[model samples]
Target: MKKLFLTLFLLSGLLVTASCNNDNKKDKKETETVEKETVEVKEEKVVKTPTIVGVAAANENFTTLVAAVKAAGLVETLNGDGPFTVFAPVNDAFAKLPEGTVDGLLKPESKETLTAVLTYHVVSGKFMAADVVKAISDGGGTFTITTVQGGTLTASLDGDSVILTDAKGGKSKVILTDVSASNGVIHAIDTVVMP
Candidate 1:
């Protein structure tokens, strides 16, 4: 009888211990799960915004422009903090130049010309299609933007496209418009219109 009593007492104690251990383990697991969730939230907060030219740089199609940007030493400027609007001319745009024009411009001595040409394509602020149209409408006839080249270029909305009238009275159509970048916007042009 005493032995039976002793056995029952021991069993109860063991069960109690087991239950306490299970409770401790469950509490520990909950704590670990909460810690993991906190870590994941912290990681999400560190996600960085992409650069403006990062997209264009990855594009195989913009190789010509990429080279020009590098040669003109304006890559860092474009990559910097700005909401600039760039009128990017495509490979076909470069093709419109006379023979050896592009090559000549890329040379060290022609940095001024290259810089001017490149900067002429860029405006200091972010000017979208809506803003441009509004400006033109406000202007009554047409709006003129003085290029970095010391020449004037006319900006007018032709249907939906933003047409650039160069200094020589030559017109170049905006092929693709409103390419968003980190620092600015890019409007692709088919022909490099001189101003």
Candidate 2:
């Protein structure tokens, strides 16, 4: 009877130990899961907002523009902290240029010209679509915007669209506007405007 009692006692102790181990394993697993969730939340909150150049680089529509920006060495300038208003031209807009024009401009020898052309599309301050319309209205149907390239672009309203006339009299219609970035705004234009 004593042996039996001893055996039952040992069995109970073993069962309790096994149960405690199981409970510990469960607690450990729960802790690991909670840690993973916390890490995931931290990762979600760590995402950085894109700048103007980053926004252009991430967009498929601005491939040509991004390339031109890089080629002209204006990536840093455009990416700087400023409320710039960029009249971004889409790939289709680049294609609308004369054949071999874009290639020539992208060449290293044409960096100055390319920079000027690119900067022509950028205004010094952030001007939302409404602000531009208001400026046009306040200017009596036309607003002259001084380009970063030291040239002038005339903004006017055509029916319901905003039109930008370049220094050389090229016209580009604003197709998309108010593309917000960390440093500026982008207004997509249907044509490339020359400086």
Off by over 4 Å in 2: 1-44
Candidate 1: pairs in clash: 52-182
- How do the residues 60-175 of candidate 1 rate in per-residue lDDT, one tens digit apiece? 65777778888889888888888777778888888888999999999888887888888877777787767777888899857887654567778888887778888777888888
Q: Tell me how candidate 1 scores on lDDT.
A: 0.80
Scored by lDDT, the top model is 2
Task: Write model 2 residue lDDT over 1-195, tens digit each, in one string.
Answer: 999999999999999999999999999999999999998988885556688999999999999999999999998898899979999999999999999999999999999999989999999999999999999999999999999999999999999899999988899999999999988899999999997
- Please state the error at residue 1 of candidate 2 in Å: 36
Cα RMSD for predicted model 2: 4.2
Q: For every candidate structure, what is the RMSD over all alpha carbons to the true structure, in angstroms?
A: 2.9, 4.2
